[model samples]
Target: MFKVMTGKQAAELINDGDSVSINGFGSVSHPDEIDKAIEERFLDTGKPRDLTMIFASGQGHNKKGAYADRLGQEGLVKKVIGGHFALMPQIREMIARNKIQAYNLPQGVICHLFRACASNKPGILTKVGIHTFIDPRFGAGRLNEISKETWVELMELNGEEYLYYKTPRVNVAIVRGTTADPSGNITAEKESLIVDALHICQAAKANNGKVIVQVERLSTNPANPRQVIVPGVLVDAVVLAPDQKQTISEIYNPAYSGEIRMPHEQINRVIDEIREIDRRAGVAKERSYASMIIGRRAAQELRPGNVINLGVGLPEMVSIAAQERGTINDLIFTIEPGVIGGVPSVGGSFGASFNPDIIYSQASQFDFYDGGGLDIAYMGAMEVDQKGNVNVSRLGDKVIGVGGFVNITQSAKKVVYCFPFMGGGLDVKFDNGSLTIVREGRIEKFSKEVQQISFSGNYATKNQQPVLYVTERCVFSLTIGGLALIEIAPGIDLHRDILGKLPFQPIVSDQLKTMDMNCFTSP
Candidate 1:
């Protein structure tokens, strides 16, 4: 049987130098009250020090910052390991300053590592990070000097090469859920569906570690069998945190998705007001008006029966456009990590949400993604080479680590990469509703060779996958020779916008036409 305690009392179970694993994906399923309790404990007693934390999602507590951020601030954590830290800016900065040790791993690999521990396995072996930064021969997954450690090693089995991934024995496991029944069965239905709370608890138990679950409520009767995510056998302690907030989503509030169904006329009026201001400024630049132009263009792409997966950055704006166009109902939108038919949380909290229609654990979600279940996937690329191999993982000294980019891009049948024509310092303009290039960003996305090949052009070519590169100035499609320019933004010159910056010549199609005029028109 599991004992129930308040969040504060539950957190008291942890001790100094404990290797704790937290069950969360970005912000969803995070134990906020437990996190607060830990923070308060650190503030009052300052007992725990040199702790190592393993998390599945991006670091941070709530939207403000990551849990590691607070631990780093209090000098509590000695080292950290997990995938994605967009929500944990403070932790990233700490790594930059050499204040803490951090390792950014593939999201799926992290999930497997926990599962490996649960199964009493020594380590995990896979071909996922071959030829990438995670490969041991290539710097051994080092994000910073403090994080430089050889975690992955190349090994041969049955005359085939594989990467061996090792995970530390967990000392304690922290998880969050909707409720804990009297029998200790935990239901996390209202939170991320993708997480395997029972797996974490079982893994911790197998390692002789304690499992702490922070729940929103405690039920008297046995939870419905179908609703039980973690069985009673795996649970040790159930923490009743009534005041713990739910992860941000429609389950908490609809506004997080920014889907406000407004009248078409009202949307047009807003566009008109924006265009009038641009006209007064006497600049037809798209940079000054990209928000409106991109939003309008994305709205046009939203069609009924389209199962769309929106990428981060500018692609997120597509959801807003879809909502305004009254197509949000028609489309089933999903995020990378197994979240289906729901508005994805943005910024650092980039994982499954609490209000999704369906959720699968990160492992199962990746299985679907890697198996090519998605019809269309909109991704953001930092750079695209002539071969169409995308670079989204590493950029020079900075390593963001491929979270689910490889799986999604490789699996999606129709992959559309939305990016600016030029990065760094670029500008654009519109004349009589036609786009014009005014200034240019310094960075080149179309590079001679990408820093890392996260998405292999050879794979796409072999599979005959459809790939389209959508930019502010032009649209290109993958061809046998190279990227073939198919369309240009209205008023954009081929020589100035397309030919001038590329390190090599690109195939120009004679059938190329101007991008949609409505793309620049007021909504």
Candidate 2:
């Protein structure tokens, strides 16, 4: 029913003005060979112009001239509907310049939309984007002036309001897997993450569209039915790429695919290697004294036997601190890409877990997240306002977009935001449990109002969700009256260091106390 083809031949299957959905999370599971082939064909022949590119999670390495950037040519991509774009610089540049129509939706919502599309559902109705930027009352997820289409609308059912996200027609789906059988049965046993491949393939097939799969190798015999992720009936073409890497980071790691469990000592070495790589690439700040302090403070919120998710960036420090406290194994860790109960990898290998307990589809994992399965979710914040609303999506002219922030923060029983008090050029030092600010940064993250509302404080308060804002200098708890100062670092003057920096006054706790001395100093 399906034919085997070269990457270039498979690229030819994509017609001009087609809506293409790519199944991947970050750089993992990307059909790189086929995508590169498409780029080559477009540059040489100028065919397949004005395409609509869609993806749930942002793909590409966090650099220029890589991944999605290959297809970021002027006429190649006319529009982009994606979740996160910070890693895809060229595509982000096009969107920022208004050269393309762009809409930034929540990653989880996009993943679920694929599933809805497979069944020919009109749209998805959920409270995930309510009161956030994706809500119709706000910007409705438009990233630039050219994004004029109405894909999300506000609706009310049974006296409750929800944001209904319309499904888009997927004419082609670019998916990747480890191996393909003679019948085009795809198995992902060697891939790092399955992502939304199955749903994307089904969505395209349901619409009488093509499903192009990139696999590492082809098998002469039929594949076992139990191991086939996408049956042969759903596959239209199979492109063999024998040299495919597991992820953008490594060539192949058995631990990532759950083929083998990594030793605790070996896992530490891998983490160290990743941190060194991140440091060299400038993807993350060197584990500074301030970051350690913030991490230590945030890790205190973790309870034993709790299911938690530590978001990328500043929130990742929480895990390092938890590991230092010897409490990392006591709690379960989950990532947005559907990995559960294993140490989540960092840097370029983030979406893939090392020795995972279970790997579910991205949509299924979001179903758990949307249903309040997370006990606590620690995320990074760009700005915090008096209303207790946090903004991690957009800042000034940059459109970072909410990537699972709305879903996790809105549904988690407890939400903790880890951030620095100041931005740009902050300097700090600690001595004998006392913290001192050497130099303040030019940018103030705490303000009277934020530029965007990624997480609605009012919504969380309405649901009686407990919230905390953890910083290097102090901690604030979200009360009914807004942000309440609960803890202050020792040797930091309240008036000069804390109150003077804030644009508005906050209610000081009646029993305010000094932060634990251990948080400031290394064990």
Candidate 3:
């Protein structure tokens, strides 16, 4: 039998110097009530200090002082082993200031590590992080000076190199579900997305640790075994938060829970509602001409019946472009959170799909992705060098760790990197199917060398993967030598707009042609 406790009691169960694992994707499926209680306890009593916090993906409400960031007090988290830190500004600040030890790994690798911990495996041995920052030769996923431990090791397995990531022993798991019974049977029937809660629970139980689950309500009737995601045997305690939300933005949406298959038209309405919410929240919406041009060209790369993954930021416009071309149904869309064949929600509700065909654990989806299941992947790039190496994880001072970029890009048969030619206040105008640059951006995206390699060009080249670099101004293809300029937009001077802006010279294809005019005009 399992005990039912308040959020405060669950928070008290956590002790100092314990390794805690949290389950969530972006803002979805977070045990916010428990997280809040822990924060309150830490502030009031300063108990449960020096926790080693771990998460597979980002868990934030797209704003400060929400979600996992609530537990980011200086003394609360002594170390952080996370896959992504874009949303956790408070914790990231600690890492920047060298106040805490931080290790950044691939999101998929971390998800698989949780499974490895459940089975008492020594570590996860795979080639997912080869030649990237996660490799020992390339900084070994360390985010700060204090993160000196070698969690990742490069070993030779049967003449082939592999990255062995040691799994962390979890002492406590804070998970969330929709419903629970007195026996602690947990069901995620009402949650927006079931990320890695099951794996987290199993890992905790395997270590003889505590598993604290937050649910919307408690039920006397026994939960159906078919619907029980985490069995009672694995769960130790359940906390009831009657006012729990499905997502940060949504209270309850049957479409997100797969209870109802929303009509395609209604899916569009859901997207509109999210955009409206963003507008009201003062989020800066980027509806720019450069993104439109790049989105149209990126959408052209899609093939019928192809399984695709689109990264956040500029790559999100691909879905909108496909919608304009009436080909959204021809291709199957998948997100990193195991949501397949549905319209992916944006902004605060990113990880959840509006009407998904199926939802699996994040680990299962990565298994498919790591096995080369993705036909094509379009990802955003912060920097692209002449060697076609892309960097989306880090900039000068910020360490926006790679979430799923490395896993998808390295395993995909074909990869297309999408980003503007320049960043930071780039302005453009399209006049009657002709492109003109109104204002140049302060920063050039293409450079002599990228600061960090999130996706290795040499690995892609060695594997013979097709790669393309798409921008609003021109298109480049990966060649044996470097990037080759293959196409340029109309009404744009090649040397003045493209060549002059590039820091290093690129191979100009003799058969270079003009970009499709249809991309610039309205759909």
TM-score of each: 0.81, 0.98, 0.98
Off by over 4 Å in 3: none
User: Candidate 3 lDDT, tens digit per residue, 334-393?
Assistant: 999888887888877888887788888999999999999999999999999999899999
Rank by lDDT, descending? 3, 2, 1
Residue 423 alpha-carbon offset, candidate 1, angstroms: 3.9
What TM value does model 1 have? 0.81
Provide C-alpha RMSD values for all models, in order. Answer: 5.8, 1.2, 1.1
lDDT of each: 0.70, 0.89, 0.89
lDDT by residue (310-429, candidate 2, tens digit) is 988888889889989999899899999888988998887888888899887999999999999999999999999988999998776676778888888998999999999887788899
Steric collisions counted per model: 18, 0, 0
Q: Native-vs-model 3 lDDT? A: 0.89
Candidate 2: lDDT over CA atoms? Answer: 0.89
